[model samples]
Target: MLKEKVALITGSTSGIGLATAHVLAQQGINLVLHGLVSATEGQALANDFIAQYGINAIFDDADLQDVASIERLITKAISTMGSVDILVNNAGIQHTQSAESFPLEKWNAIIAINLSAAFHAIQFALPAMKRQGWGRIINVASVHGLVGSVNKSAYCAAKHGLVGLTKVLALECAEQGITVNAICPGWVDTPLINDQISAIAKQQDSSFEQAKYQLVTAKQPLPEMMAPAQIGEFILFLCSDSAKSITGAALPMDGAWTAQ
Candidate 1:
């Protein structure tokens, strides 16, 4: 369904971003991969996509914390790939600490990358999408966007901001053949959670299996982590013609995390 379309996914080197890239490539979409990785590593991923899917793939190294870097990366991708019909703002960072003790610099950094970067990407990509009269902006938000958690002040704040941005942008583009939405995923089995899991195990003096189950099932009724590929598939569905009418929605794949 995505044949001849071009997609730009930030943080595409691994985890959700990489899985999304692979899923989109399978649909014959050209790819613009972004991440903080060695140039050679990025190129290698690009080559693999090209070889496996016969779709054009390029890589750009971008620092989400820097607006200038994001602008340059989007410009380069547009110049090379012709135009970006799909943009997935998947780049983010997390820090767990009490609000009172959270470093100001760390808070700024998390907000910059998680919240501000999505705004920057949309601002840069919107013009081209407007010209084409068709586009999709998928923001990879989290369940934290809809609910609160202790020791995650910055992360939750940024995600909540992203959710708000998604709604506004979706409304603005509602009649313009462009759709904007945020995917609020619960706990996903990604590298980002690996550290937290290990820490939980140490803190609780529990086995890895026990820790993993507790970490997600404590707040989420579901005991399994949502797979990255499952999220990618949902994105593919959203990009389809059937989803043209769906906009301004903070759809959750949270395994009933917010249902409570």
Candidate 2:
């Protein structure tokens, strides 16, 4: 069903977003790569998909924090690839600090990128999806959406709000041929996480391995960091015809983080 369809994935320059783009492309889907990366880098990534998959693709370096930019991305993507049948809200950022010590600017930024961007994208994409009578809206939330942790006030709040929005939107679109859902992933061994581990090592004055181990096993009993491609594959499944009935669900890719 994904064949020839267009999927605009936010934050597609690297990590899970990029991985998801590859899987979607493999399924014969066209793409619109969106991220904060340079235009050159973004176009290069888009060209790679076109060269490898022989599918239509383009890059948009839109500032997700700007509602207008988000709208332009969808508009341009539709003009480029025909229509956006799949909308992946995957762009995100993180800042860890005590709630009391959390910078107001950081909190606002997190809420804007992590939460509001999804809103703007979905709002803009919904009409097209509803008009076509078939679409998938996947919000790349985090394990923090389901549960809380220390020193992650802004991220936690934004993710929680995302999950809530996912449910509400799913309910509203339940009758429509559109599905809205959230994917709550655990610690994936991405660059974003590697940086966090480095910070942990620095603060604790410990080896990288020690900090990595502690961080991975802190709540996730699996004691292993998941691969970014795994999340991508899972998303592909959600976009499949089999997952048409799945909506308003907050599926966890965490290794039993919330289980404990």
Candidate 3:
């Protein structure tokens, strides 16, 4: 369905973003992948995609925390890919700490990358999408966007801001053929969460599997982590014509975390 379309996914070198890129490519969407990986690694990933899918693919090393860098990256993507029809703002960072003791720099960096960068990407991508008269903006938010989490002040705040941004942008673009929405996912088994799981294992003196189970089932009734590929599939669905009417929605794939 995405044949001839171009998608720009940020922080796509690993985890959810990478999975989403793969899914999009499978649907024949050309990709503009962004991440903080070394240039060599980024090129290698791009080459792998080109070889596997035979779809046009390129990678840009974007520092999501830097607005100028993001702008440059978006410009470069547009220049190389011609135009972006689907934009997935999936770049973000997580820090767990008490709000009172939260490092100000860390808070600022999280907000800039997780929240502000989305705004910047939309701002830059919208004109081209408007010219094309159709577009999709997908924000990879977290369950924290719909609820709260302990010791995750920065993450919660940034995701909440992203959710709000999605709503407002969706409303603004409703008259146009553009849709804006957020995917609020629960605990996903990604490399990013590996550190947290390892820390938990050490703290409890349990095996990695035990710690993973404890974390996954803490507040969620689910016994497993949601796969990044699942989230990618949902995104693919959203980019379809059937989801054209679905806008300004914060759809949760939280394993019922927000259900209780």
Candidate 4:
């Protein structure tokens, strides 16, 4: 049922979002890719998908922080691809600091991109989804949404909010043939977390591998870090007919992190 359907994924230029795009494209889904990359780079990635998957693809660098730009993004996707059958709200930013010392600007930016952008994207995409009587809305939330960590107040807050939003939207669209859910993944071996691992390595005077082990083992019962493709595969499963009944869930792919 997903073949030839259009999916719009935000923050899709790299990391988990990019992995999800690849999974969807491979399923014969047309794509509306969004990222912060330059237009040329974004278009090249879209072209690559088209060439490799023989699927339609387009790229847009919409500013998620701006409501107008996000609206335009959804509008353009619908106009170009007919409808956004899958909406992945994966764009996010993080700033770590004590709650007391967190910069207001950083807090606002995080909330805007990580949380509010998802809200706006959902609002704009729901109409098209409702019209078709089917949609898959996946929010790439984090384990932080279910639990918490020090120096990650804003990130936790936004992720928690996203999970809550997932539930509400799911209920609202449940009978309407839309499944809204969040994927709460633990550490995925993505470039987005590379700097953090490197910093841990420096602080502990250890190798990157050693630091990565320490980091993952600290919270996850399973020390192995997840791969971006694993999350992509999970998402693909959620988009299938078998998963049509699994809605309003913040499913954790987090090595049992929150299990403790």
RMSD of each: 1.0, 1.5, 1.1, 0.9
Write candidate 3's Cα lDDT for 1-260 as tens digits: 57979999998999999999999999889999888889999989999999999999999998887778888988898899999999999998988899999999999999999999999999989998998899999999989998998899999999999999999999999988999999999989888789889999999999999999999999788889988999999999999999999999999998889999
Q: The CA-based lDDT of model 3 is what?
A: 0.93
Backbone clashes counted, model 2: 0
Colliding residue pairs in candidate 3? none
lDDT of 3 at 259: 94
- In lDDT terms, how accurate is model 2? 0.93
- Can you rank all candidates by TM-score, best first? 4, 1, 3, 2
Which predicted model would earn the best TM-score? 4
Q: In model 1, what is the error at residue 52, expressed in angstroms?
A: 0.9
Superposed Cα deviation of residue 85, candidate 1 (Å): 0.2
Per-prediction tally of clashes = 0, 0, 0, 0
Q: Could you tell me which 10 consecutive residues in candidate 3 have the lowest summed lDDT?
A: 62-71
lDDT per residue for candidate 1 within 124-206, as digits (tens), equals 99999999999999999999999999999999999999999999999999988899989999988998788889999999999
Best by lDDT: 4
Over 1-260, each residue of candidate 2 has an lDDT whose tens digit, in order, gives 67999999999888999999999999889999988888998899889999999999999999988999999999998877789999999999999999988999999999999999999999999898998899999999999999998999999999999999999999999988999999999989888778889999999999998999999998899889989899989899999989999999999999998987
**lDDT by residue for model 4 (1-260), tens:** 88999989999999999999999888999999999899999999999999999999999999999999999999999998889999999888988999999999999999999999999999999998999899999999999989989999999999999999999999999899999999999989988778889999999899999999998999999988898989989999999999999999999999989888
